[model samples]
Target: MHPINLNEPATTRPTLAESLSFTCQLGECRSELLPLLSEVSKVVSGEGSLSKTLKLVLELMQKHLQVTRAMISLYDASCDQIFIHESFGLTKDEIEKGVYYPGEGITGKVVETRQPIIVPVIADEPLFLNRTGSWDKTVDCRLSFICVPIMRGMKVMGTIGVERLYNNRQLLYLDLEVLAIIATTIAQAVELHLLERAHKQVLQAQSARLDKELKEKFKPANIIGNSKAMQSVYRMIDKVSHARTTVLILGESGVGKERVASAIHYNSSCGGGPFVKFNCASLPESVIESELFGHEKGAFTGAAARRAGRFEEADGGTIFLDEVGELSLSAQAKLLRVIQERCFERLGSNESIKVNVRILAATHCDLTAMVAKGTFREDLFYRLNVFPITIPPLRERGNDILILAEHFNAWFAKEQQADVPAISTPALNLMLNYDWPGNVRELENMMERAVLLAEEGVIHSYHLPAALQPAVLGELGEQSGLEARLSMMEYELIVEALARFQGNMSRAAAQLGLTRRMLGLRMAKYQLNYKDYRCGD
Candidate 1:
C-alpha cells in the first residue's frame, strides 16, 4: 500500500462525479471532525483523565464512521505486549482479555512497524486474528478494519483502531485519512498522560526513600537506653525482624509496646511494605470483626461502601494488633484462621481474600491467664505466641531512668525552642528513687513537664512533679528509723560538701563543720564512694 500524503495536492483536476463525491465527504467530515477535535483539544489541555479522553475519541469514531467497535491498545514496556486500555462498544470482560504481543496480529504488526494498516474486508485478511472476540464473522462481511499507530516521534506508544461498515471504496480512503488525523491528535494526549504518570512515579519513589531513611534512623536502637533489659529487647528485635513469624510483645501498659512493633516492621525484609496498626481494645466487640476483616457494601447498617480491613491493607507488610487480648471470641476465631491459613472472608461475603502479612500482636494482659479463664482462645494464643518479647517496665530498668531522662529533656527542650537545662544531682536522685507506676510513658511526660517548668538552665528537684517528691522521700523514710534518717541527712550534706570542695577531705570536713575523722566515719557508714564525687568535681 502506497502512503497517501495528506499534504500533497491532487495530481490532476477532479472529474464532475469525483468532485461531487469529494464535496459530500468533506461536508460529512466537517460536521463530525470539528466537534471531535474541539472536545479532544479541551480534554488534552484540561485536567480530564487519560481514560475519559480516550473513551471520548472512541465514541466519536463510532458515531462518525459507522464503526462497529473502536478501541485503543496501549504498549506495556514491562510485559512487551499491547493491551486494550480503553474502548467503545466492548464489554468489560472482552476489554480485560484483549491482549496482543508485538507482531502477533494486524494491530500488533502496526505497532511493531510503526505504520498503519487498512483491511478492506475481514474475511480476506489472514492477519486479522479477532483476539478481542467482539468480531462476529457470520454477518460481518462488510466490515472494514482500519488501525493507525499512535506515535511519539519514532516510537509506537500504542494503536488506535476502528471497525466500520464498508461503503464506497473512495469514501473508505477518506475515512482512513480522518482516522489517521484523529490518531495523531490522540497521540499527543497519550504522551502527556504517560509523562504525568512517570513524574508521579518518580515523586513516589523519592517519598518512599525518605520515609525508609527516617524509619531506619529512629529504629529501636534509638529508644534511648543501653540497659541490660533494653539490650535484650534489641537483640530480640534483630532476631524477629528477619522472619515472618508471629510476634507476641508482652509488657505492661506504657512500656513502648507499639515502639517495639514499629522497630520490628521497619527492620524487616518487608520494610518496603506498609505498617498498619489497629488497637483491638479501642474498637468495640460489635465492630472489631469488621475493622479487622473488612465489610462488603451494605453488609451492616453503617457500612456505606466496601472497605478493606487492616489485614487486607497490610498484605505483604506487617500489621501490629495492639491490645490483642481485647478481641472478642468470635473475632479471635476468624483471626486464628487468618494466622493459620493466610486467608479470610470479608464480613457478609464468602469470597476469601489471601494476604501475606506479618503479625505483631501486643497486650498488657496475660494471654495465658486469659486462656485459662476462657475469655481468650488457647489455640489463638499458641498461634500468636510464636516469638515473645517482653519490654521491661521503666521502674525496673535501673540507670536507664537517667539515660531516658536526659534524652527526653533534650527532646522537650528542642520542641519548646528553649535552652536545654542540666538536671541537678538532687533532681536526678529523686527521679531514680521513684517507682514509675505508669512506666516509660509516665517518665516521658514528667520530663516534658520538667523542661517546661525549668527556667534557670538547671532542672532543680522542685521542677519535677510535687507527688514525686513525697514518694521518693517517703520510700527512704520508710526504709529507716529516726536515727537512720538523721545519718542519711548527714551523709547527703557531707557528699554535697565533698563535691563543692573538689573531693578534698579536709575542706569538705570544714564545710560540713566536722573534723576529718567524723566525716570519714560518716562516709564509711553510708558506703559513699569518694572517687565518684571527685570525678564529678
Candidate 2:
C-alpha cells in the first residue's frame, strides 16, 4: 500500500479514530490499546520533571510496542528548527545529529503539515533521511517509520516519531494509531515547560535592567563637581562604597551629606536592600530612644502598639544617621552596642533583637570636640570613625559654583516648566564672591529662587538672593565698589584656572593669558593659596 498521508485539507482528512478501523480488521482490538494509552497518560501527567517524564514515556513506547527507537523533538521558535529533546534506544551522538528545519525530513514534514505520516518501508522511502544515523538502512532495511505532530489544540508544538519492524500495512496503521495518542499526552507537558522558561527569562531581564539603572544613578559622576576638593571626595566615596565599614561623613550643614550617603548605599554590596535614613538632630531627647528602637505596646503613655525601629526596618541593608553627634549619651551607648554586636533591645523591651545593618553617620559638629566636652560618647566616636570623608565647604570649590548653578538652573527650569535663563556677567561675579556659608544646599535654594524671579530669561545680579547682591553687601557693610568687584572677579578667574589645572601655575597662568609672575602677584594680592587647590586637598 502507498504510504499513508493525512496531510490533506482539514475537512477531507479522516479523523484519527476513523483511521483505526484498518487495525481493528487486523485483530488489534481498540479495547486492547486502552491499557497502553492509560500508561502513557499517567507518565506524562506525573509530577516528575518535564525531561524525565518525557524520557519515561519514550521507554514505555519501546517496551510495549516493540519499537526499535523513538524520540520527542521540540520546536525552537527562535531558530525555526526542531531538535530532539528526549529519546530512547538512541545514542547521545545520534540524538545530537537529529536536528531538522520545518519540512526537511519525515519529522520536519510531520511538524509542518500538523498531521501523521506512515513510511511502510524505510529503504523504499527517500523521505526517511536517517539524519540521526541510528537507523542504518544497510543493516536493517525492514524498519517502518511513524511520525505524528505533538499539538496543543490546533497549534503544532513539535513532533514524536517511532521506528518498528515492518509487519504489514494493517499493523503499521495500528502503530500510527498508538503513537498519535501518545503525542497528544506529551503536548501538555511540553507547553508547561515552554511557559515556565519564558516566565524566568522575563524576570531575569527586569532584574538586569533595574541593576543598570541603579548603577547609573549612583555613579560618582552624578555628584556634579570637577574641583580638586570634590574630586577627592569622589575618590573617597568610590573606595568605601563596596565595603561594610562604618563611614563618618564630616561636612558643614547643607553640604549634601544625605546625598553622599545615598551614593555609598546604592553602590555597595547591599545596593538592592532597603536604605533607611534618620536625622539624629531632628527628634527631641524625650522620644529619641523610642524613635530609634521601637517601643512595645503600652510601653509609654503614647505607645499604643508595637512598632519597628529604624535598625529593624534596615535589616539586611543600611541605616544613615544624619547628625549622629546630636544623639544623647544614652542613645549613643545603644548605637554603639548595635555597631559592635549587631543587636539591640527596643525601648521598654527586655528581649534583644538582632539585625544585619551597615551604619553611615554624618555630622557638622566635631565629634572629637563633643567627646572632649563630655557630651558625645568617646567609644561611639571611635566606632563610627572607621572611615572618614570630609566634603569641602562650597566657598573653597571655586568654579564648581558656576557648574552647580548651571545644573540647578536647568533642573529647576524643567521642574517649574520655565525657560532656562542665562546667568548675566554681574550675576556670575556676585555668585563668585559670595561666601555661601550654607554650601551646596544654599546654592540650590538660591538658584531655585532665581529661576522663579528670572522671568525675562536671564538671571541678573538683582535676581539672586540678598546675600549675593551688591546692594545687600553694601547694606551689610561689605565691599561693593566697582574696583573691589573687579578685583574679586579677577581673583575668581585665577582660582578657577588653578583648580582646573591642579595647581600647575604655568598652565593656570597660560590659561589666564598671563605670565607666571603676574599670576603670583595677583594670587598674593588676594591671599589665594595654590597649594590648597592641589589634587589631595
In candidate 1, position 103 carries an lDDT of 88
Off by over 4 Å in 2: 1-221, 471-537
RMSD of candidates 1 onward, in order: 30.1, 25.8
Instruction: Count backbone overlaps in model 1.
Output: 0
TM-score of each: 0.51, 0.49
lDDT of 2 by residue, 134-239 (tens): 9886777988888888887566778888887765655666677678778878876675455444433543465456446545433464576666687688778988
Q: Among these predicted structures, which one has the highest TM-score?
A: 1
lDDT of 2: 0.79
| Residue 349 displacement in candidate 1 (angstroms) | 1.2
Q: List the residue pairs that clash in candidate 2.
A: none
Residue 434 of model 2 has an lDDT of: 91
Evaluate candidate 2 by giving its C-alpha RMSD to the native, one decimal: 25.8
